[model samples]
Target chain A: MSAPEELTVDVNGFQTRVWRKGSGPVLGFIAGYGGLPRWVPFLDHLAERRTVIVPSLPGFPGGERGHTVLDSHLDWIVAVRTLMEKSGLVGADLAGSSVGASMAAEMAAVWPADVRRLALIAPLGLYDETDPPADPWAQRADDVPGLMCADPEVWKALKAPPEGANSIEWPIEQVRANEAAARIFWPMGNTQLAKRLPRIAAPTLLLWGEHDRVMPRSYAARIGALLGGRHETRVIGGAGHLAELDRPREAADAILSWTS
Target chain B: MKLMWFHLMPYTELPDDFRQRHPSVWVDIHSELFDPKRAHLMYNDFMDELEYAADCGFDAICVNEHHSNGYGLMPSPNLIASSLARRTTNTALCVMGNSLALYNPPTRVAEEFAMIDVISGGRLIAGFPVGTPMDTCYAYGQNPSMLRQRYLEAHDLVMRAWQEKETFAFNGRFNQQRYVNIWPRPIQQPHPPVWVPGGGSVETWRWCAEMEYVYCYLSYYGYKAGRATMDGFWNEMARLGKDRNPYRAGFLQFVGVGESRQHALDLYSEAAEYFYGRCLHVDPKWATPPGYTSEGSQRAGIESQVKQAADSIVRGKSTGERMAATARDMKGIVDNGYVIIGSPDEVAEQLREVAVTLNVGHLMLLLQFGNMNKEVCRFNTKLFADKVKPLLSGLFSEWEDRWWPKPMEDNLRAEIPAFLPKLAAE
Candidate 1:
């Protein structure tokens, strides 16, 4: 596989960063909470199969930050739809992880024509009060890695700033991503996406991390059941939330087989 | 040089091993630990102490807001301030005050504060604190990232509600209202003087300086630890070209006035221990939630707080140790200036220096703190009013206090307390 192409697009007045590579079919990917600051091995693996397009959710890692004030869930969803359209990923097979996964799944639900096939890895939209998921926002900064990943060291390694990037600005960008997410899903992670799940008509794949502490495997089963059309659950072992970062090869294969 | 009587109103009946058993005094502090019957007594005693302070001739009587905490019992400080408004006629009623973000519509705050001001005949120093992370974020579920934004929006809404004569539609990001028409308009023209109580937030001093509001530094760590925060405020004032009228800034300090140094220690030691050891026994996790402090504040030392807390976990530093709380003893408290304790003359001299050095005019003194009994709190209040206040009132007398509440009558402090503590024994 050749080098991934870095690009930028305007999403509803907000300038967002996008990355594209590989050939075949267009695979529009939305990144997880720990954003794709650098091209992770997972993206490299996924790129081997088909053309992959990943847009930085506004206020996420590479996205323009001063536009952190995305007011509500509707605003966020519309912004995601714009990202899909602007990145030329309309009608493409779509995938996302964690909060990104939630946005991807919502795109299929609310704007069904935007996403042809859906792959959501540990999506964080549906919140169960009886068996609540761990609040990623509430965790201590140092402890967050251990909470989200099977091995904390994997997260530390993934967070290394790409070459030619400001080492100081890298951490600041990550915090801005969190701040943006917190704006939409604060107090708790519930976006009431369960209400809109039945609207999704696309064939969906719910991939969950076996060791995921943030959103457990139970959430995937619930999400699979809630999705409108045919959907299946696949547990990627030796991983946690945002499984692609932890078990990139395994996560890539699961998505390629199910969605590609 | 206006002296204000402030009370934290800490719960009085935690067991001797409360800190050992409890993870924190805030947020997850067990509900079962609170006994309403005992709180009933504590509440009345605390109220009596404030009234006594008013009678003892403090310029202002103050109460503040906190939630789900063993440290501060006044979740609705407006309720306390409203009650104080009715009971005390002369002293300014300072509600240190409602956390603007926690209230919905923001007009709720404006309406309630107006009621307090009207009831007090315009003696209201409205404190607009963004609130601590434990209170606003955890207890009230205000998002740490948007807490300040919500607070600022609420501030704008509340100010507009007070100043706008006609009902107006408020369209805010966090809060909205179809019509904001507040009844019982504040007796003070436009609104009561705005006092923003801040702790380690860089944006607050800038905001306060821009708004020409009083920036009250309400740090529990006393005057020594308070210098940096106060200096930051003054520097911002100087840079902004705002006059350092002293009243433009307020400072809270734990104070104890006794016959001598030993007597002061004997009087305040247990309460200081209880306050520093138990009242501040916050779990490190609950202390600094992410996005609670801004980037500028993060640089200013909020990061150091989080870093210290993380190190505290590694070093297994107790709450007492984390705060450098002077080892929960009177001597350490004095050494750290966590509490000012000495004879009336000594305390007065030291406090005068604190006022001049920190350049703060509105001195909100914690004469009643921790689990001190009502009698002692009154004794401390009366002693400070009689001795310490007179000495310091002359320090900044040349500068006019523009931020004070212009009351209908400032004659409230003339009345003496029912009884003073017995000083001389046979």
Candidate 2:
């Protein structure tokens, strides 16, 4: 019902802002390319029974100001692992979307003992030559909203420029986030996570939206199979890449059923 | 004033429907659009134009680096600079310059520049650019956030390598070398004078000012579009208590010279259209990769102003309204000061105004642009050299240009005759 309180946390050397709420079992959520928008009803729904922690990935809007020199995906996994450990998130449930989803899988594979459950929404790092994912960096700024969401209203709402911010401040914020995303996912998002997908001992949940054109269903299926046993796949209807924002009820129900 | 003839060496023969069918002229544009047969002639002619400019008595001839683009065919400017060093004898070599961060050790840049300096008998004005986002971030797949950091580190390494006489170890964030020695040190003491070419970034203005390096504004939009940027640099220089010597800055402008103003316009209108319409049809997305603008720069709000100004000009709107690049006709280009098309006197007068207004002592002339043929390019270069240059050469004679090449005096500046005269004896 209320907006989550924001907390600034320093992991190792870098710092990031995290949004947290609820009081039950700890759950860590890594943001996607569009980042954690102002509103997310599913975050509230999940917060009903579980404590949720969302850290802004570096280079995005509210993340640490000056740390974008990640040499490889392994460096990113190590950084995220350090953050989780620093945040006291031992054996907790971890969820990620898009670039974040791929990072979550990496954390699960690399530090299995620290993560009990893994949930990926429109996850990346899995490449399908026949059915490849859309490049967020290549798409025109005007075409971004439509490509991101299936619903026209949501698309229109997202495309509208922010109010109160000056012209320079507006694009500056967007470019910062985009720069961070590009650093991690440019050229291609594949970190060869498929090789380590089977190493993820935690129970995995793969969620894909029916209208999610960016990361198609083929990727979800491939990730599901690569993850081997103790994994489940759920396809949500009438939603795009951001199922939690589009069909929050359906997304919440799936997460609740699995975690409960 | 010091005059340098700069060439983008554009792939001039793009299909008429290139803008309509292609998403961009850079980065991801299909390679099928490029035909090697056509490129053979273009490259040779481009080189001929640069050589002809040198022969026409231009003080320096310039070349630069770009990648995977139809706009500039010189991915490795050193190759062209090297070839030009052999062909020309007197003119200073302004290799304005190689992309430092792209090299692995970055000593490669130092070594190549040293070789060029040695070959040219010490005539090399080294230009260190952060490079455009499309070149570094997308085409080369460098991380946008770390690119500047990498560039800075590479710069430190390159400068130190060129200056240090003895072998030393360099442990940098981007590169680590056990033996940091480079052979064939530059002829210019403590290395050649460094010139930094940048699009209007506030950070660059500050950096160039602090380093005391010549700050060059290389915008395709020309003198009018560059007013704010040049003003910002001068203001920064004053803030730092640096001298207001006009020699501290260089500005690039498109120039077309003919027998008369009307004839000049008629000669260059199609060429200007080809350049503005097709050569610069870059997708906005490719141009600005996120994090390309640093958080500090973004916060400072300078990048925004530059972007807005550029966008307005592109849209043909009079936002800041000084010079609209979106007014994409020959007349608009001429009127907006994007291109100076006129007779010798008319062109010289406008150039004098530009020099005085911008306070630039080193002026880089883009005389041959777009699809202008070899004959036209040579004619433009010669006319400017013979007519316009002499008038404006005395404008900034008060200040010394420390950024210019210090070529050996003993070596004769061997001049090639413009054309052989027929024998008079019968």
Candidate 3:
């Protein structure tokens, strides 16, 4: 089983990058900020059993920047919808990491017609007044591995600093923009997601890193509790915020099992 | 008693519309603020803030590290310390510091501390922390089982780099270098004073005692909460045949002041709520990760929080209720010996009591609480310096001469590598 040809589509006035592979129910992937664009490698191991679809998000690496002030959730949802229509995708499994997980949750909540199953790996968006806030930009790019895994050596191995095309580059600007975005949404991100969790009709699986310093696994329970649909929470041992990067085999297996 | 002020530079206000379109505003609170350009500006402002603290009569201004998180905006405490080294006159630059075990060579810390000490004219307190399980074992991907060992090794390596004068070869299980040499040696003889900050870990106490380092318990929960842990430390110190001399130990407390206790409590209640409720909310999985915290420490922290939550339920306490209900008992935790929050008179009186009770010489005041407005923090800081410091200065001035390290000749020292015998033979 091999990946399909790379496909390009216009989504919300942005040139979006999309790729498909294998021949089963379509599985859409939403990546966290700074994630590699080549989703084929990530899905290559799973392509044997199912088909997968991954799109490069706007303003992210390899994707065109859309509106500067547009809502990220809406932009992503619309982009995924546009990609699905262009690629002739019907019902598919959905998976996302970090910010991507929030988008995946939103997609399942608002457009249940497009998703049959969903998996969120160390997903974000669940903010309680009692939990610590995750600041993606405050960290040195090299320090990310540490933030995402339980084993320092593993994090050290993954410590490829974001650079050139792959790098977000303007960290301070990104941080300020994020802070502004957070204030604008107030509690909507939390309240809306909590409200829409009940609307997610598809089977859902929540994967969390046991050592996730960013969005601690405690948020996993809140995520599971809010999503009124059938949901299971799996905590990946020795993983951090970026569970897939930290413990790929375990994360991939969890996703494959849920989708299958 | 030496007084240190702790500040966590947090981006308090977020732009309005940014929160809406973002997928997860909760997690991304400070990401946008950390953009390269903004980070440069924030760093400058943060440095200025710390410099201001120095000018306000603080003995030392502290900074620490956190990543991909808004709680403590400093990812590189060294950067801030470096800046403070040039900007401040007398205040010591406490890097409270780089997680030694997280660095590959650990000598990077040695070199950096040496550089900062020279830059700051011999005013530097080198802090070597094992780091929290969340920080070390999880964030840095260190083996939790070997975290303590790794930390100790790193500590030794850095210390050797500072104390030894000659370039040498070295090898170790975690760090290996053909030639070991650190430039720009520290001005403080035998290196600046070493301080160890712990979150009530048993291993940390023994290590501090063995090393004869100042053991600073950064009590976030408050004083009463750390009683058992402090008692355990004292017992260990006794076992090591160390005296109950207060100069050998210190504790950190969060203090807030206003015109009256009612005003102080009301003004600080929101910040406290933010700190405990929003800032410290750790998922049970992350908080009690498998093998992250020791069985005993984990059990104790959980039990304490649970008991506090249960007590809150029975008593109908609104303050700290939302956050406390989820975890351990925090009541009197700070009061027991960790924190003192009130008006100047009240906080000073409590400090005197805590110093007497703990029989300690140093008090690290976390003057800045979660998202506390700058104006308020400045006011609180001024009040403490004016009213509180005067009350306690007399108590410890005489002992300073007896216990504190005397001024030493400012000069570069030799460096020592891991394999001293091999280098000597060569």
lDDT string for model 3 (B1-426, tens) is 777777777654433333344332123344555466755665555565566667778778998766545456776788878877766656767777778888888989999888888777777888887775446544555554345556778888898888888887667655777777899898888888888876655667777878878887765655555455567678778988977777777777778877777777666765654565455543322222223344445444445455764222212111112223332223432333334667778888888877767666777787777656656777777788888888886666556423233233435422323332211232
Q: Give the DockQ ranking, best first.
A: 2, 1, 3
What CA root-mean-square deviation does each model show from the true structure? Answer: 4.1, 3.7, 19.1
Candidate No. with top DockQ: 2
Residue runs of model 2 more than 4 Å from their true location after superposition: A12-15, A37-39, A69-72, A128-130, A152-171, B300-325, B411-426
**Stretches of candidate 3 exceeding 4 Å from the true structure:** A1-260, B14-45, B294-339, B397-426
The complex in candidate 1 yields a DockQ of: 0.42
Q: Which model scores highest in lDDT?
A: 1
Task: Give the Å shift of residue A8 in candidate 1.
Answer: 1.0
Chain B, per-candidate TM-score: 0.91, 0.92, 0.81
Reference-based lDDT, each prediction: 0.81, 0.79, 0.64
Chain A TM-score for candidate 3 is 0.79
Using Cα atoms with residue i matched to residue i, what is each candidate's TM-score against the true structure?
0.92, 0.92, 0.54
Worst 10 residues of 3 chain A by lDDT: A179-188
